[model samples]
Target chain A: MTAPAYNKPLLDVRGLTIEIETRRGPAVIVDGINLTVGKGETVGVVGESGCGKSLTMLSLVRLLPNKIKVRGGTAVFDGRDLLQMSKSELRQVRGGKIGFVFQDPMTSLNPVMRIGDQLCEPLIYHRDMKKADARKRAIELLKLVGIPGPEQRIDAYPHELSGGMRQRVMIAIGLACDPELLIADEPTTALDVTIQAQIVDLVKELRRKLGMSVVWITHDLALIAGLVDRVAVLYAGTVVEDAPVGELFKRPTHPYTRGLLASIPKLSDERASRLSSIGGTPPEPGRRPKGCPFAPRCGLAEPICHEHVPALLSFAEEPRHRVACFVAQRQMMEAA
Target chain B: MAPANLTAFVDEDPPVSLWRDAWHRLFRNKLAVAGLVIVIFLALVAMFGPWLTPYDFLTQNLEVRNQAPSLAHLFGTDDLGRDVLSRVIYGTRTAFVVAIVVTTVAVAIGVALGAIAGYYGGLLDRTIMWFTDMTMSVPNLLLVVVINASLKTPVTAWMEAQYQATLNPFYRQTVWVDFLLVFGSMALISWPPYARLVRAQVLSIRGRPYVTAARALGLTNRLIIMRYIVPNAVGPLIVSVSAGLGTAMVLESAFSFLGVGVNPPTPSWGNMISDGLRVWQHYPHLLAAPAAVLGLATVAFSFLGDGLNDALNPRGSK
Candidate 1:
């Protein structure tokens, strides 16, 4: 693992917590989390469904319903705390500075509106440009995203375009304002492998061209491998481990991270038995273990691991590579 | 551009307009087309009925009162000897006007209230809905009847005053007062349901992902409603307007039949039915013709409305 000196973090989130008031009581969905995305760097957040990864990104935009509230946290992006911003103020930051490419391209786009009108809405609202200019920019964007006949495609509806084309259009819309940061939540998950690769490559190319920071939220470890600089592994609404991509994959300190890594099919392995699946269902919201949230299913869990929650301890006096497990930390230092 | 990709050129299809799609689907429904034709014909008759007929709708002759169907007066005559065919023709004008005005007003109020209530939840939604609920709680027909009844005494007094001044038979009648009762009362009663329908529809659509995308794009609430919310919610609105028109016509006709809509000396289909029913055995043709017009008009409007509802919503396609 190497430390590439960051210019400056475009987004720095610290002590972020999210909770929803249920009939039972206030259920914590996202535990205290800290992360940062350097200007122009891509940080991949990988986790299974219900891992609170989606909530983390959504909370940054303050898009979650009123039922879900940020219990405590500060999301400082470009000198402003996003949590403190009002609805109107947040709107300026949301699409203007921080672009979001949602998962379902079909649903994300208005089915009734033309591609041109949809693409130009952001320029009109945030940039306050003239319609003609917005339309011109939109055509350019569609072309940039590899859509052919940009002029004609601009007037097409969401259903008329293929899934890949729709996704490209979504990317164009997201990058319309040249946002400082792009939060892509499973942007390629719904697509086929070739199309997924195309989207990934397109994102990477766009990042290079625009030098924009991106938080690529996905469940695929393989997709995150070559794309992201750092990786954050989440389980049961908490980040189990956070480290540089190579280090996390090479020497995963968290058992859940290890299981997730091992779950990826390797080319060399030849086995008669079925491919490994993470045993047991993920712990539901309120029923989360009081100590280490992963202790119940973790085979490495000791008595102490069940008694108290382990702080995200460093692997070897190194602050950058951290894991939330006392047993895992001790094992790591001993091996070192 | 070297050999502009032929497949790519073909793929870039234009988005279909919602109005165009609605029109396309409407054409597919033959019954709706037939209904539209009837409604148009009825509208034309209403607009030009006065010019087409010689006998004034209000003119009455006690000497020739309650005549049966004859060669000269096609549909025969009412109790006052005012031609039933003439009155029914002019009544088309009243029905068309009342239906158009009341439906337009109702839909305007309903769509506004519904969109606001749906788009903005919590207290705003509840308050608007509570008002809708209060309106819906009253039996619509009974409420309109009471409202109409309250206006009658003043109207009767006004009619007496007009009769005293002009001494013309038609001026002494209750025609103008009845028109006011039908238009005003129905408009007041019809708006609540449409508001409720729009509110329910908006509530569901406002939370959809596209709406979220629109907000994320920093679209103003007004622009979002106008461009996104209204267009999506229009299928229900079209249905409401169509059915609402039919309902308004029936309400007006009922009031006229009750002698509270347009009074004696002046003739309407409902008033003719009221006057003819008394001498049913002798002059059955007088009641039959107006009744036929009312039934046919209602059925035509309903078919048109059903067709419109089917055609306007593309998602309605299986």
Candidate 2:
């Protein structure tokens, strides 16, 4: 991936391992994930369902579900290790320094609560603002999110708002304290296509205005195509390829990434052709194939690819792009 | 420009809260409104019984003894020569007090224990559920009888002794012993259902995305519970508590009828009915007033509970 144009690592996650306690034993769900988001940079984490994309972000905030344990990890945010922070320290960081916008706007907001109160929660708690001040700020936040008649809307409950409006409220809540980093986990996945584009646009506009680092987790490659500065493609919990968004689109080096890109139905394709799909599912948590987790699914898998796991290596020709594939690495090494 | 600008017209109707919405729905049901009116009437009678009653309940006149229903005495006089109307009015006070206190105690215990058990889960949950099951398994009337039979005399004697030693007028009120025993015993038996309901509620709510979102917002567990979990869980609780008030009143009456609840001079409907039962062939008015009032209360609360259940959970209604 290209060096942060901001030249400061806002969030650096290394060897972040997460395990879920299944009946069998502790199954490795997220195995040594390395993710970094620079200040003012929007990084899109792309992966299929159950590939630890959400889990990776959730674990950074120590918000993993019960029975899921973080075995090892160091998520350094602004020189502080988030994983090792005390409850009090984390509380200040959460919603203050690092805001989170969760998926499923319909369910993500407290249904019984007023949208204004929900928006004002982080403000009151993090900033310790007076109720009147918080109310004023809540209206401002609602206005900032482009909710019509913010004053009148503040008193409205979650059920009264449309899905798009509710998601906008969620975004408002995330941006409440003017957080340095906003980790939005597929915030627009539940919206309609038109609404999704609008949300992307709103986020793009907000990002330019707020100048905060964003880590957007989603399965939709095309949706985040123009939104993200860098893209880290995860396959079965590992970052198979990480590169600048433009470079990744131009030449997706990892087999899984290529397969993913191919799967996206293009307008240039024949109308009758069956939409290309990656064959077989990603390996299960407890039953990851030895060597590479993607080896079984890879069409160009060599005997050596099955024998040894490939490390993420930067191509000599394109130092900014990295690919975790033995075949891709060998091919690049031969060319160089 | 003004004609086209009409699209920006804001609807000025007040925002509808869940509680307000539920209120509107509750009022829509005819049976519920009737029940609410009857309950309100009963509550008013209970609140202002002393001022409203024509005669002092304890003041007896042999001349008016066993008088039939007339303008002077609406419900008729009992064999004791005591004004039956006044006694019935006072009985309303007893029922309301017993019902409200018992339900409050039971609900407090239930909400606290249930929230803890559901939120924490594991061993705490297992133990609490086990305790709840154990409490529910025992017969309610039997448990109240056993407690009253075992403790009533001792408590009254202790109060008498305290009055003698301290010269405190508070201890002289032995009727409080009857009330305390009834309240405690009834509360003990009544809390299980509430605990179960709230535990189930918290269990379901614990995994909701909003709760996860709340956690992500770094809201404290207490705040999350108070603001998020409790409000969502309270709708069913309100319905249950309405029903519970009725149940508590019925339970109190049953205890008083069995000579285990509020004693004489307190004018309880249960004891009055018990007294009226023996000579029902001669003077049916004695039984009719208290019995009718108790039945009315039970039905009122039941209808209100049903209405609340429908209102809170709109999906459950037509």
Candidate 3:
């Protein structure tokens, strides 16, 4: 696909594969996946639980947990390959160029340290800021995240703050260094619905104000409907569809993407009717179908869909929209 | 919606840190407070015992032998006519020294080994854990006794040789040899439990989300261990240490009673109790004084440890 001349991709990950060591042997948890975030773009990575969305983002920073390793991948951020960078160079990119917000705010923070101290840590390490200067900046960050009484709240421990406030603290920390890219992995799954919206709005405002790209990974498609510039729908470790946010909403081509979009409870639905849902769970890692990973669960799967995997191809009508589905590609070809 | 007034909900009282909160909880428990008070009192007595004793513990007064509770001697006199109160007071000093020194050495060794094993895991973890397990498998008393028996002669001989060669007054003091042997043997056996405790603590804290978050922030391994992992792992260690001090005191006393630790005239409680046990039929105060004091110190420490465990882990208490 052709890229806009002015918009250079900030972070481009190609053929990223992650594996988990199991009793049997190493099993592929994240297959060859490709994703990109352009400058100042917000990309929402939507998938079901255990579909490897989080692992893909974590693998970019080499932060996968023990026994779950990045088997192969090349994540290029700002012209340099993150997967091939030296230890020291990778460290510079970690909190300095790319910040990460984990899923659970409650446990992501150091319990013994004060919020102020935790915030000052990245500044002192990455920026070489003096302790006093770091403290001042920490107070400013607290204010930026909409936390009240920045001075007093900074001294409060993680337990003292409410869940919403703690999440705000997490966001403030993620934004502490003014990173070029922020990877937030389900930053609001643990919060109340109201708090979730508040967190989304906070990130949106900060991204617009600071002009930093964001990769938000979440299982909820509806949660990121208005928050992202594009959406990459993952099914069983691979991105089945990637499209502009509005185009994806208008026409989700991949069967799995269609199922996910259909599952979201619409306000216009019948009051007492049950919510629509996909029929089957995503295949297990080692036990994935030989052909398309989603073929077993895809109702529109044909004979060829079970024999060979489909490569991601751009739609003839919209070059920006890409889908990897044999049935969808055949139908589009016939219509054309 | 317009931003809610977030400051209105702020508590009137300033925020108390987790440690301060735990301290407050500890103070509220009457039993723990009593234990703390008793421990402080005993520590003070141990520190000032020399000045507090009216009579020299070594001084022999044949005329006043076997004297029962009197103004001249509060706890009464022993078979040798030495003041029992003075000896027991002096014993307190020995108990404190042995307990403190042995525990400090053990904790240092244990923390270093355990932290390294838990953090680095794989071959190093297996090797360290194997060593810890082997050390723990041996009988505690047998190990201490074997070490004292085998090492004491060589250490004492070396001190004597140093004295002869250099005429250094420091080497002439054979009491140091006894203490050196006792401390080494006791510390050797004392460390395995702490090593295991710290290893388990580190294993759990290593997997915590905060530690992973620290790594994600590009913090060095040393920084993550010192700032994130160790601080979180120290709660259980504190409780273990409190309980350990009491156990060390008892271990020292038991060894002294068996004539293997802090040999005669060093004024350990175990030696005094041994002396008291022999003549208790005629003079029961001799045995009762040191035994009662030892019992009190042990009970006090146990209570304080329990209180600390509950205070540090509030969730566990419920």
Candidate 4:
């Protein structure tokens, strides 16, 4: 695949390192990560749980949990550095230019607030719309999210709705201001499979209609295969491979990414066959291996794999397909 | 399901807000309902006690002095010939006033300080908590007694001076001095619990995902606190206030019985009970009248508070 060159990306994050305070001392959770989402692009951030996928997205908006600090990062959105922006400036950017849909819709929404009020909150605050106008927009937003009888549903509390409906409301709230980018962090994890497909389709349809960039964070690669334009596979708080969706599936160069892709049970697999899975778990935050975080789990590990961390390098043929693995790079070089 | 049928189950009844939901839960609890009814009845009686009382509580009928329960006087007459029933009704008024005033002042101060401390933790939280701890460390009765004893004389003298200088009837009203001392001292002691309750509430609520969602919406801190945090935090506060009202009434009665509460002629239950105690062996009616009513009020408030706590926090119950 030919690389789309010369255009500046919409959001460029470089050397993003996030740390958490522990009893002994501070430990790195996200270690000098680099990522980019282009204009009108839908990028899937696929990772296992605790791979810092959610943390990376949250830190872009300076919404990291207490005692977890962003040690170093430059997240350039539009033209300004998001990390360096003042509080008021950041406020203008959040829910105005950038939207967020959290994982658990059940707890993420305010239970006491009516759906209408929650929908209108951003409109009133960020857009400075009148109450009546915001109410009208809220109903329209409810309709936009395919909620039945939006006029009546607007008055319902969060508890009154089913999980899928609540997630749709959450998405409506995220899209209330017609933001330039939407950061959805596992928005479908808590939902059932069919409902998850519906949400994905809804997001895809909405993105097509609105032309907004989306950073879809999820642990399910198969779920986002047809939805995202590109995929960034995260393993142990670092991006191991990033490529166009088709290319990533065709050539998963990183051992971690390959293992993740292989783990997704395919329809052609024999019913009685054992599902393939990578041995060993991701290292704990404070006790991570010195060289490569994935080396201990990589079947292709050599003596040097434990001595030096592999830097993310682009494939010689396709510049857009980047991979971080010493063995993979050496094999490709030997093959050439 | 089709879109129409999808909402059918949820749409059968009108949507209920959180407050209405809580109210519904409260009404279902029979003990809470009974308590609520009694509290309302007492409050109404207190409001209209003067007009409703058959005889003046203070108007002495010398012929009826030391009488037992009789047809004309329901609760009989006291040693001073005052109607025991009328005095008990007036005592209700005193209890209600002190409870309402002290609790209101305490809640307001507590909510403000607690919200600030909880929202902005660090030196401010430490300082406010330190101050709260210091105030709580002092014995409540001792603090009130000290305040009243030390401040009452000078305040009364100042009121007298002002009455002489300005000839204002308001200044001449010495009962105002008693009320000011009682309210001020009680409010000072009453606030710490409320402050602690609210602080703990705010601390827990601050970490809730909805609050974080609110911040993500670019809402100002003030809006988030008022709209998100405070509304959620207020459920426990309501239960506390319900219980605190009863506690305040008892505290007032105790202080008055000890001669530090509202002075004589106000017909406070505490003072009335104190007076009745002197001749209780001869006339048990005197002691029983005021004591029974006070006990009833305390029990009613406690039941109501317990009901509210259970209703507001349904998850805590089975």
Compute DockQ for each candidate against the true complex: 0.42, 0.50, 0.60, 0.56
Candidates' chain B TM-scores in the order shown: 0.87, 0.95, 0.95, 0.95
Residue A235, candidate 2: C-alpha displacement in angstroms = 0.9
Which of 1 and 4 is ahead in TM-score?
Answer: 4
Q: Residue B55 in candidate 3 has what lDDT?
A: 95
lDDT of 3 at A178: 92
In candidate 1, stretches whose alpha carbon ends up further than 4 angstroms from where it belongs are A1-7, A315-319, B1-9, B12-14, B48-51, B59-72, B79-81, B152-181, B262-267, B312-318
lDDT of 2 by residue, B26-66 (tens): 99999999889999999999998889999889988899888
1 versus 2: better DockQ goes to: 2
| Model 3 chain B worst lDDT window (10 residues) | B1-10
Residue range A2-85, candidate 4, lDDT tens digits: 333326789999999999999989999999899999888889999999999999998998988889999997999999999999
Clashes of 1: 1
For residue B311, model 4's alpha carbon misses the true position, in angstroms, by: 1.7
Top lDDT: which candidate number? 4
Global lDDT for candidate 2? 0.90
- What is the C-alpha lDDT profile of model 3 across A230-259, one tens digit per residue? 999998899999999999999999988888
TM-score of each: 0.90, 0.96, 0.96, 0.96
Candidate 1: give the TM-score of chain A: 0.96
